[model samples]
Target: MDLDLAQVRAFVLAAEESHFGRAAEALSISQQALSKRIARLEAGLGTALFRRTGHGVEPTGAGDRFLEPARRALAAADRAVAAALDERRPPRVDVWGHLYAPMRTLAQVAAGSGAPPLELGHGRDLPSVAAALLRGDIDAAFGRVHPPLPAGLTHRLVRLEPVDAVLSADHPLADEPALRPGQLRDSVLWTPAALHRLDFLHRFAERFGIRHHAEGTNLGLDGFLADVAADPRRFSLMPADVPLPDDPGIRSVPLVEPTPLYAWSLLWCGGNPRVDALLGALAAEAGRSRWLEYDPAEDWLPEPAGEPA
Candidate 1:
């Protein structure tokens, strides 16, 4: 026999309310419709389920016996529907650039807290990265956002680190405390051939109206440094985090004017659960750090459990 949840619900309500009219009203259905559903239910089980009395209604022996199981089955059906609705919103996996450091720390925290390790993806440039995000190709992205990012994407600046200008010791600007974008004009500039190059050079050039030359066809770190030292006039820029070369002939000066600071941010589409989770984790880490240094007494008030304190 195939039992229906609607029939089970009707039977429970009728049994609980003990009145066909009140049960149907509680269920927001016509009493005749409720009676028909109950009749169908009883027919499926091959038993008479209720006796209609003048005062109200009484459950037959078969109906009384089936009551508990019927209620359980209806509850299970409701839970199944709820679960289906919840599954309509699935969590997403995160994707980040190779240079993302703080998120790597957060990923470690999530792992320690039993979250699965993050997944990563790569693209040649920021526009390409932003495109992938717009197309739903990745759940979240991590990298620098020099200006306000693309309109739809949201970001949180997690960390900032200094980048230094690399030069041969004899280079004219090597000793300068900071560099203005204009000073590098007519100089051979070297940078990674990756997206970061375009982000720093092209964008900076456009923003500050500086003319510069890109060194070599493809000058990577090793080649750029080699080129810089070989030709004392040529200089390359890299993050200050790079270990200083043993060659006292080379020096790294922290650049000022356009402030050579690199920003690391977590970004995602405006509304997404995976991104939300990632942000929440990041915020928790920040809060933990902040609470340690400057504790806020008002924020940690004791909760009232049994009696008010």
Candidate 2:
């Protein structure tokens, strides 16, 4: 049956006070109005809820029975409203990346003017991470992107790094100030090719005339260093900002003369918070670092037949 919450509240307060005047004062309504609300509630339930006495009033058996359930209903209503409001509150946007040097740089850039709250998701590579971003499971991801970025999903160039070589310690050119491209022609570059979709890495190997060994992703860092130390003819390319292993068996040197860049970007689907604003801040912040940057307008993807313009 239809029942007013106000009537229920008036009944409860009046029953508790046992005095119509005191209950009215507590409810900020006139004595007549309080009496009328309680009367209406009692009539709806077809029972006498209170009996007038010299002390003012007292609950009937029916009123006492109704009091506990009425209080519970009001408490339930309060909880329902609070839960509804909580559902309407804004969502927390997330920023995700591996904890590499470039990712650290991205964190600084993204914290612009202390804006939209960020949840940092970490230690994942691009393929799985990109899938999550596209599925709206994550807000944004930071990593090097492969070609054919899906429609409606775009990238902002955040950090750019030159390719550095991990060379055998005994290699003749390892002592040079930096490596020139001409010396790279006869070398073979080995990579964790099976672990990622790095089209750019393969293309860079082709453009620089270096043979590439598409090794399986089973090697650990120590194992990789051992492989490098074991061969004078094999070298590996890594992002310049990424830390190299400290080993006397190898030398880490930047590649020069049309230096290949490893570009990282923020990839997102439509309508995300702080993406454009954060990208702008990143551009300004990166200028202070040694890494070169692409214009914010240029998509992170490479230009065909050449470097990003």
TM-score between model 2 and native: 0.57
TM-score against native, each model: 0.49, 0.57
Which portions of model 2 miss their true places by more than 4 Å?
1-102, 107-117, 122-127, 212-223, 274-277, 290-309
Q: Indicate the TM-score of model 1.
A: 0.49
How much is the lDDT of residue 254 in candidate 1?
A: 71
State model 1's lDDT. 0.61
The number of residue pairs in model 1 that clash at the backbone is 0
lDDT (C-alpha, whole model) for all candidates:
0.61, 0.64
lDDT accuracy of residue 211 in candidate 1: 55
Query: Where does model 1 exceed 4 Å of error?
Result: 1-116, 146-152, 175-186, 194-197, 206-210, 217-220, 244-249, 281-309
Error of 1 at 175 (Å): 4.7
